[model samples]
Target chain A: MLAFLLDPAALSGPADGASDMHPTRQRLISVATRLFQQRGYHAIGLAEILALSETPKGSLYHHFPGGKPELAEACVTRIAESSLAAIDRLSGSGLDMIGFLRRLAEVTAAWLQRTDWLDGSLLAVIGQEQGGVNGPLSEAVRIAYQRIEMRLARWLMAEGVAVARARDMAATIIAAQEGALVLARSRHDAAPVTLVTDMLCTMVDRG
Target chain B: MLAFLLDPAALSGPADGASDMHPTRQRLISVATRLFQQRGYHAIGLAEILALSETPKGSLYHHFPGGKPELAEACVTRIAESSLAAIDRLSGSGLDMIGFLRRLAEVTAAWLQRTDWLDGSLLAVIGQEQGGVNGPLSEAVRIAYQRIEMRLARWLMAEGVAVARARDMAATIIAAQEGALVLARSRHDAAPVTLVTDMLCTMVDRG
Candidate 1:
């Protein structure tokens, strides 16, 4: 669980005005998304996000319109786009399932270190805290997960894994990756993420 | 990533007044632990905890003089003690590492179902939300994870795994389990958890 890639990459979704969005609006969403990822929805306030982004409160209302949840929805959209792009970028390359996962481990570890462990998967933080309760956010979270899983499953199926097995493998991989991020952040170490990938790759090699 | 088992099982630790504590206090801790596990530390409030537990405000203050965080610390303590006991109980049985992991998956899945997907790892929810920011809470979360990792590593070492490899495997398993809980809860399905354990067990069995 890391922040979304800003490049947006070559994926199959609308860009959502991210490139052309107002600078102030983009700053608010970026700041809010990171804060929400770190401290969660209930803990952080809009004032802090506004002050951190150096944007006035009126512009926030003007851009987000629906305030916090609305902004969070944008965060979800941005995250989903960025994350899917990341997956696409990795999978489309010459990486198999294990290679794709190993690369993910490296990227996530670097991200954690670069951010000083302050950032994690926004969808994960939101999903765990507000998973079933936060309506639109929760729905987005579910869809994002499903999309990521489907992509991973497709990768597995390409390797001749049965459809059911591929789906299960994808689900398990995602769970471990997300869970590893939490553990790594909590322990202030990235070994957990790398370890899981290593173990999985080793197992696959053995088979 | 589930609530603490109440029986406390056999292990070493101060009982911490759980058994003979005032019913009101016990109820407060129990209610607070479950709520914190579900909605996270910041999302749920003292008033809501009190209302859910049906305890008077006076009783709440009398038990936890330090208030919300204090109660949360108690919840953490209770959970830590409970989780350690769960580990001890599982490992001390005749189950090997694979069986131990398999049993854990089943229990976690059932816990998810029994709780209607609301409950998950308390330390995980709190750790992600307040991991680095909340001082005492963060410290407790780190220790809890370390203790669990050590226990799992010991189990692996018992299987003749080398020290470093066992440690990585332990760390990876914990990360996956915790992450699986988040995914399972988000999707309101326990298959993610069961799927992870099954994959790990199959890999182990194959080896």
Candidate 2:
């Protein structure tokens, strides 16, 4: 289910073996993303990230010279790219629009349950906490969310919805899912997310 | 728009003069609420709150003996009470369900614009950041959100919807609005929120 929101491949390591494959660097990025998603960006410090990643202090500066901000930016970029790819893959599948939305919701709910509600979409956390405070991080989050919205909009358009309508529907879907995830996590239950999924399906089917 | 999510009266001060009228304490609560809403719960420090509130250190400990956590709880409680009161006022105003939601969206959008998207729902910031991390704070946030949801459900029930269906729809409405607010704040525009509002009104009107 997390794959629907963030690609596991991106979290683990680089897709291409061309470079950027240092085990220490990959571990740092992976751990940082998890910590940021779980505990928020500001709450987690560089020492914690370093200690959790088990990477040396020297290696941290070597990989990310700009420190926490630089590392956060990298995590956001990777997650964004992976999420966009996942969207493309899902949209290209043989399922119709309604089917796609149902599948997406199921995966999301399952992911939330699996994580014990400790994590939600990275985009959501970033968008909520860091959106306006940090310039580069905020921009990265915006781009990530916009890319996902555009991907959803394209799917709606393919199903015969008008351009403007498709865009609006896409925004609604993303926003609703994000909000439901927070509710679900807060209550430690998946019912909120499931309810939202059903509503989205109904609305899209009617359209 | 903020009045739709959080009552400005709550943000500023008490509407009545019957009691609970400690100006220093009230000022502390108000400033803490705004800071927590704009930045986040963990991001804002007690010292900063003191500086912003312009209250003495001894006074902070005097009013909120439990320190930052106590102050945060007070803020959450006050905001929740004010928000519920605002909803009551809106629902009692004789507007249909659609009209109520449109007004809510408009007010929320305008608030976002007015604050340059730096501020969103206090419940949202608390629910997203402190939820699942701080036990007391999480519970406070949950109660705040649930109270709002129940108020919304009551409105739907008054419109002749069944109890169970009304409850689910209310949850959906809150979740969607919360999510759209994040998107709007992230993009530094209110278009996303406006789109969600229109869709919500359509759904409620049809039902």
Candidate 3:
């Protein structure tokens, strides 16, 4: 296996060493994630991913035995971890939970701006594509959402909201963020991201 | 050109009559909308559309000179008009604005229950796909959203909310629905849909 470079965010997990990965596998994953993010999943091909990664066919399969599906799973897992870490880091700050949420809002707005509104979260793309089909990718999508939802729920609980209300609010918070991204992307303005986040934060705080 | 069997929901628009349509064009639009909504825009092929619609290849080109893009535009427009009518009808029931919104929540829930959550409002799909892309599709998406936002703003104004707040709330409410649908689709549950609409309705009513 090529050496997998540990993402700073993923370092908290058990795989502390860069020992396990082949360099080509790491390159393949990074390239796949960006391609999948820009175009819908089915719209892309293995050759494109391999070419983009500059890895040979044998090396590509050498790491991901399951081919495209395996690579996709790895990409989803990596992206999910990175995203969760960012959210956790923001929310884990010493500030109050509401303040943490506000900070998250800012990060999300910045993300929309930085990507020029083209980057819908990877889990989201998978969620939309596999929404109808029942498969591992779909499961991966669910697990990713659950991770975010659980984290948000915990933050809301820390803020003293009821468990049920907190879960609902977390879901609403997510919806607002996702929808705001859609709007910002379409409008080419990050203004909606900020506005939606503020309104949701207000709703959470008022409760 | 096959005759369009008018759906009351579809026909409420300003250009409702089959008298106005070239029969083949009407059939193509109706067939394309169903296929696109059921199986996504890219997954369905032109041959399948022509076969199912019983329209010849020549007629398809005659109607949609720009081919898939043109057909896609027609589908978006038809669905957009149909959606606006549905929203209008639901919001126009003798119920006040709040009541109308509440019923809309229920109606939407019922609608989701009927389909396998497949035929999402087309505007929402276009909104996501064309959000950051500058093109005719993007403009059409923006205009469709503007229409929804305007109707929602009117409802909020009737509820005695201040104008600016109403507009802000209108945008947020729309965002919530779009976002909530994404969430609901991800989780394969109507709960998020109900939760978002309920929470927003309460938020609006309290204000």
Candidate 4:
């Protein structure tokens, strides 16, 4: 679900820390992703991101010539990649379908509580902020969500669910998770997500 | 769900044309609600709302002493009232649980297609944009959602579901519907919401 935005991968630079990549550029992405997740896309400014990242004011343009939108695009892509990686890791862990979902929900709920409910799935924020608008950022948001859905569908299919049913269930789970996160944030509590987790578990058990 | 933003009441002046209320104020609220639903709360400016509402540039502060935040408060309240009215109308129709949920989803899907997916629930947008922050606007957003949830729970209870389960189902339904709307808007199709409707119907039938 959109909970992938809360993954530590979203806040860290590339795993290898290749010498060719500038550390400042990675820092900027990390800061921007954090801010975007906590606040809506439009509520944040480039100046704040640069200051928080400790990058030189003029260097933002040097690294991202396209400015805010360009930086936003990079953050979206980073989040998507990190989220897909997390899903792959979970899927490979040998947990049953219900076990995997429960673990995912627990991680998400913990993150929400840790952050004081200030952060949620960046994909959800961006999707709502920029959905239906044709742009690189919007396209990035769409792709991120699709990747999560596909990964979930694969996990469901591996559990012996029919292809069509797996896909539908994956979509429903993703949608339900995203919605529950919103409710959790709004109510300043994680119980909504817990309820959703139970509901999804029941559905999986029924099948 | 957040689908109430698509209600015509959200875009029109108060019903029964009160003699004391200024039409310009009503127009401003209507325009602001529409823009806020389509775009994030922080992305839109007062100038744009006033221009679209056809209100005089100087009259904005006169109608809304608190400026954009105050205006946002009014829009939130208007949406909540309109949404409650919609729920009341649906409940009074005496449709069975599945029938009512399916009809609600169908109407929401039709609205998404009508606006070409440019609009969604104002409550969803505000809840994501301002939730977890302390302010009147954020509080208003919370109240709006709670009202919707309560109305839904009341319907479920009326259908013989236990109170605890009814509340949980209400929250799940609201969250799922909001999430499905985001998915549908992002994918530029109503199939996501249609899938959600089916999932919701099954859950309701089970109860």
Best by TM-score: 4
Q: Per-residue CA lDDT of candidate 2, range B1-207, in tens?
A: 122365345466443231566889988988888887777778888889889889989999998899988898888887777777777778789988888888888888878887778776677766666545758888988887788788878878988989998988888888888888888988898987888887777778777
lDDT tens digits by residue: candidate 4, A93-183: 8999899878978888888887888887787888888857898998888887788888878878988988998888888888888888888
Worst 10 residues of 1 chain B by lDDT: B4-13
Q: What number of clashing residue pairs does each candidate have, in the order they appear?
A: 2, 2, 11, 1
| lDDT at B21, model 3 | 84
Q: List the residue pairs that clash in candidate 2.
A: B1-B107, B1-B108
Provide C-alpha RMSD values for all models, in order.
3.6, 2.5, 5.3, 2.1
Model 2 chain A weakest lDDT span, ten residues long: A1-10
Candidate 2 vs candidate 3: the TM-score winner is: 2
For candidate 4, lDDT tens digit of each residue in B2-113?
4453555544634323336578887887788888888879989888998898887679999888889999898888787777767777789889889988888888888898
lDDT of 3: 0.66
B191 in model 2: Cα distance from truth in Å?
A: 0.9
lDDT of 3 by residue, A55-103 (tens): 8888888898898888888877776666665555655667775676566
Error of 4 at A133 (Å): 1.4
In Å, residue A71's CA in model 1 sits off its true spot by: 0.9
